[model samples]
Target: MRQRLTPVPADLTGTVVTPGDRRYAGLRSTYTTRGTPEAVLLPRTTAEVAAALGYAREQGRPVAVRSGGHGLSGSSTNDGGLVIDLSALNRVEVLDRATRLVRVEAGARWAQVAAALAPYGLAISSGDHGNVGVGGLATGGGVGWLVRSYGLTVDHVRAVKVVLADGTVVRADADREPELFWAVRGAGAGVGIVVAFEIEATEVRNVGVAQIAVAARPDGSTLRRWAEVLRESPRELSTAAMLLPYGSSTVLSITAVVAAESLRRVRPLVAPLREIGDLLDDRVDLVPYPALVPTAHLHPNVGQQPNLTTNGLLAGMDGGDAAAIMRAARGRHRALVQLRSVGGAVNDVPPEETAYPHRHQETLVVASVFPPHGPGALDAAWRGLADRVDGAYVNFESRADARTFGRAYPGPTGERVAAAWRRYDPDGLFRAPGRLPDLTASRG
Candidate 1:
């Protein structure tokens, strides 16, 4: 028998979904974890979201906040708790065409945002996947296809409308509620539920994309060469490479994105990458920016892609560092390894500028192990490259422990992030259990 749900506030009557409701099945889980939340509140407006928060607080149950529900950590849903589902609030509007400013609701997916901005020839550098929610990625960090040229999605966020833990609605920007605005850009999950963001989009209508595959040397020479090429290349070029098992060896499959409109400019930018290794396959196409993150990738999250994921950032990749990464990818556990270029425009931001302070890192290394294998296997695989990593990206991590907090928010950045989280959410209302470290304790 289903447990009885507490009576919801009158303001949230139609917005509340219980286990008995038909929609509960779809609302109870995320992409990486299954949940059994007692109630899922679907707020359609800022007022409704405030009401939903009040209603959930009265029940004295753990509250999980969700935007697109594609978070790798699966903190958006919980067992027998209350979940604030923001999907219904999705809206993308061009606030100012002259300045390329866009007002995007938190619930809006990257795909929807791309589709909405296509006509204006403006685009925000969001994550590679279109299904990823704007709230989570923008709040945390948005390393996207155009990252080298446009920078992270959070970097473009000019302002944000958030619903605080105490049911207070406030809009934060550099000039207004400045501290809250700083935390919202990178450490938002611990502070509040961000409903919308006013971002300054870039003028980009089309780009040149290339897919290249090459046989990698077991000694990591090929990986080192790939990094060298990227370091010397122009900011317009950004690439993501995956190391896959091929026959008795490994293959480095690379997707290079160039922020250039014509093939002539794109060809020259990506030419050096082909010389890195023995190229097996190569193709380049000049396509619209929206095509890179199309609506075709939209899908519901129902605990579909369960896996263990972790990541680390590297300042530079030497031959030894490259060897360690290759060993991890070909280890006994054999975790799937992916590398993304991250320097260029990302480094243009000063370390003290925002919550995401690791601006000097040149590469992002992510490793994932699907089920049948678990955390132990994932950890074992990551051991080789552990000491070489400079920092970690919060969005790619599955475990939200103290160590991760320290890495994601290092030194002064961590201290400021913790203080901001405590100031905005003194009662620890938005800090999901085990999802974030206790802000009161010294982050090790």
Candidate 2:
């Protein structure tokens, strides 16, 4: 039987929530709100985490960890297990401005971090939105506009403070626990809970950002242009063009962002598309990085939707392949497709090093159903469509099996990662959608 602490620990400083707790429902729900846990433990300090883990280990109870609650796969949330909620550990210290490095608590959200760092004229290469937690996103192989110039967020991670499964606390950095550090940089959360992250900050200020909407070209001409432009364009700019369906007509919503002072400087580069033919609603302008994340979630009322796409170096989108790929997604099923350019600093690192595999692929063609996720669903359509996908981005990942995760990383890195995970989490306490193989066992 599980050890029941009816009255809770008197010495415990942080909040301990049970089924009767008023905040239990709110604490249990994530952004996706799919997974549910038995009880929630909000530990204010790393010491509290260690204590809780020690208790669970003694009781032989399973435990899961959560930071941002933005996990798409419900990996952090649980149905009937103990959860170490680190959402309270939101502390960011500007350790060294000269070194351009910042230490952020695992619970720190990018939104707060960005605003906090803006005053110092320094920021980390974070994902698109400020709401996403720095730890969860980085561990899953972060890919944002900054990715084009600086590489994944993991690449910038200098060190991490984590509590292992067996109540052991350790620090992983380039100098300490080098192998564990490498594994944590990309797959840290897989083995344990990270309380804090030490990452190199980028000196970023205001820049030119654009959101252009256009009439979708069904014949594949629009895709061809996007592929050619992104492949040949200079590394200074990063662009992602999306094709969404509205009624019978398709709308191409393109977001072209760059680190330039004014949009005019890059107008000539995008002029080719304007010359190609007619488009609708081109609202390309400069805006703050924080404003880019439109506050919204895709509608999920309907059944499962169709989403088929790919991500690779721009070279992978050959003329014929690009045309066929785009054409496959343009239909009544409403598979919104996006072609993302990858070159800049993202290509600086080889795929073999990190769990994030696609370092060289130039463009990521992602397509999925429009609204809702069910019976008579669009799952089959998307499954069949995306079956041809050559790459799997852990960040964009839905619920994929082990084989699907194998393709998440490059060559031998996948097996090596499995090995690391199995060693730490021998029993796979947190089993969910995005869980990889027993990394430790694989390594063994």
Candidate 3:
């Protein structure tokens, strides 16, 4: 039996692969094993993106956009719909060397951006790994090695070029389309596809890197103390502490970065961390800003595992919360609880200033359970911890329901974002995975 081919959009400048195509399997693969879309549209230019969106609107099919394809929630891929793949638009350019202003295409990876700006001694505070796409992280509020020192990637965004749901191309910034600019910073996926971004970079020299293994305390006194130190530590240092199960006893793997040119400045910033637990292993050195990205840690297995993850932002943790976290970490095998210190310059930005409203958060906690494993227990454990925190970082959230989305963008902030969704995408042609409320209908 012959199957009828789905017609590709006539104006699409890039490739389109359907279900029966040989390349479909490879094109549809992502960081998590998500459902295959009916067609994958790879658009290279902004006009082509508009054409694809117009076509998706005409077909009345759900539209999902893919960048680096490393989204843990698998929102970038879907079944029986259109997946806009932006891999062909990966270009990083230095717009101004003096101000360290850089322009990055949506499809570009943080690593490529890093490598491009390294020669000029410029860097953008991005996700921990280099392979993470600029579009997803920048829009959703980036938390990275330089978070404490420089703030989120979205903080540095000077402007953005977005294709709204109606296939209209618009430039958003503080002075132009200001409301859309605010919405795109944190709740981008809900409104439109960001084709490119102009980011203001920070000048830097060699930065300090520390990878340490410390013995974990079951009662979580160490975890509490670690949090205290990070709260009091200098903004120059940012750290991510991971609690992993290690036969009979748990281990805390600490990765810290200090944005400094000398070992003298780095040593004092890391001294408090050294006092955490029995230091099982320690490695501290200075590396170029780009080298700070831990590429090896980004999706080490690719799309093999069904990645289950939960995220929360804590203003401060008490003894009860620490004990709860330790208990959760011990529940699942190969489960990891990552707590990143996040309140330096990040807190300097007022909650109302940007779409990201978590400026009050002291720490960002991420609980991940990897594959070759069981089921509901992982989610159950993560949910228990989520109850303790104020909110969740959108990038780290795994659940794709309206409830989870509400958690990610909550209260008045959520309402504003929904209003933006209504204003920019009244018809809702751009379909995000979650069951977002019908704000447009409500407006009617």
Off by over 4 Å in 2: 1-13, 58-62, 264-266, 269-277, 293-315, 323-328, 370-379, 383-387, 430-436, 439-444
TM-score quality measure for candidate 3: 0.94
TM-score of 1: 0.98
TM-score head-to-head 1 vs 3, winner:
1
Best by lDDT: 1
- Find the candidate with the highest TM-score and give its number: 1
lDDT of 2 by residue, 213-237 (tens): 7675666666776666666666657
Q: How do the residues 1-444 of candidate 1 rate in per-residue lDDT, one tens digit apiece?
A: 545567886777799888899999899999999999988999999999999988888888889999999888899999988999999999999999999999999999999999999999999989888999998999998999999988888898999999998989999999999999999888889889999999999999999999999999999999999999999999999999999999879999999999999999999999899999999999999999988889999988889999999999999999889999999999988899999999999999988878999899999999999989999999999998889999999999998878888889988999899999888888888876766777655531
TM-score of each: 0.98, 0.87, 0.94
Lowest summed lDDT window (length 10), candidate 2:
297-306
| Model 3 agreement with the true structure over 162-252: per-residue lDDT tens digits | 9998888999999999999999888887788999999999988689988888888988888888888888988998998899777888998
**Rank order by lDDT, top first?**
1, 3, 2
**Pairs in steric clash, model 1:** none
